[model samples]
Target: MTDKQISDIKNRIAVIAAWIVACLFFFPIFWMVLTSFKTELQAISVPPKLFFKPTLENFALIQERTDYTKFAWNSIVTSVGGTGLALIIAIPAAYAMAFNSGRWTKDILMWMLSTKMLPAVGVLMPIYLLSQKFGLLDTKGVLVIIYALINLPIIMLILFNYFREIPKEILEASRMDGTSTFNEITQIVMPLAWGGIASTALLSIVLCWNEAFWSINLTASDAGTLPALVASFSSPEGLFWAKLSAVSTLACAPIVVFGWLCQKQLVQGLTFGAVK
Candidate 1:
């Protein structure tokens, strides 16, 4: 074969391979969505019925059994509230660490990141006890605080990197212009780094939303979020496969859409420093 023809064939093969890999990764999600539209019998049918008449009965059943809206609202409040709090705290901390690194700054940052490595189970007892002692269990505020604390390390790390990428000269110029320290950050640093902030906020929200262990353990009925709601499906009888799928789909829909809509910003923020 001619060199040009051989190259074209190789490119086509690569494209096909990429598509196959993507399909494999996406299959479970597709299955969940598909099963959400099936009856329990259809969902568990041998060889898994791929082409069945779709139904909204499972969704309706879910709504009848649980207050889907309340769970969804709790999710929205905690995730967004936690993300906002994390950003408020992380921005200032990262700003200081990025621009004015003391000798121990790296060690502090490493220690913070190390917290994420520790299994959640190890600290669950203490956190649960603390929450109960404070009467914060099954409360939205506590979940928000917990989510913010859990995500703080990664959020600060990302903000730190973004802050470092901001030219120091800009802050200097702002100061020369008689801007106060607060003004320098609010007016210059924040605007320059808004993209990174938005991306970080989005990530924090996702992590908070998908946090099942904490949500399930810390909450019972009142403040339980979507993840907790999803876990509640398990009963002594058996897993209602179709209804479970429906609930899972409903819980996942908003975040999936949010991620899809913000994909460009996500890509940009994650790749923020790669070009330079």
Candidate 2:
């Protein structure tokens, strides 16, 4: 084959491989969605029935059993609230670490990153006890705080990298122009790093939304999120596979859509410095 023709063939093969990988990753979600519409018998049938009549019964059953709206609202509040708090704390911290070098800065950053490696369960007892002592258990505010702290390291690291990429001369110029640090961030740094901030926020929101352990343990009926709502499907009688699928599907839909919408930004932010 001619060289150009060979290159085109290789490109097409790569595209096909990518599509196959995408399909493999998406298969479980597709299966869950499909099963959500099937009856329990149909859902568990040997050689899974792909051509069964779909029904809304599972969804109706979920609604009757749980307050879907309340759980969803809790998820929204906690995720958004946590993300907002993380950003509020992360932006300035990242800006300082990025622009202002100090002796312990790198060590501090590494220590922050190291915290994420520690098992959350190891500290769960202390956090839970602290929360209880402070009357913060099962409160939306507590979950928001926990989520913010959990995500803070990652947010700071991401924003710090993005901020570092901005030309120092630009900030120096702003300083020469008599702009305060607050104005530098709000007016200058933020506008320039808006894309990175947005992607960081998107990531933090996703992490907060999918957090099941803390949500389940920290909150009871009052502040339970979608994950908690999904957990309600478990019973001593055994799992209701179809209804569980329905609940899982419902819980996942919003975040899935949100992630899809912001996927480009997420990719861009993650790869911000890769090219440069």
What's each prediction's TM-score? 0.92, 0.89
Tens digit per residue, CA lDDT, model 1, 181-217: 7887898899998888888888788889999989999
lDDT of 2 at 93: 93
| Candidate 2: segments with Cα more than 4 A from true spot | 1-18, 236-238, 268-276
What are the per-residue Cα lDDT tens digits for candidate 2 across 132-241?
Answer: 99999998999999999999988888888889889999999989989998999999999999888998888888889999999999999889999888777777423678
Q: Which regions of candidate 1 deviate over 4 angstroms? A: 236-238, 267-276
Assess each prediction's global lDDT (C-alpha) against the native. 0.88, 0.89
Q: Whose TM-score is greatest here? A: 1
Model 2 has an lDDT value of: 0.89
Clashes of 2: 0
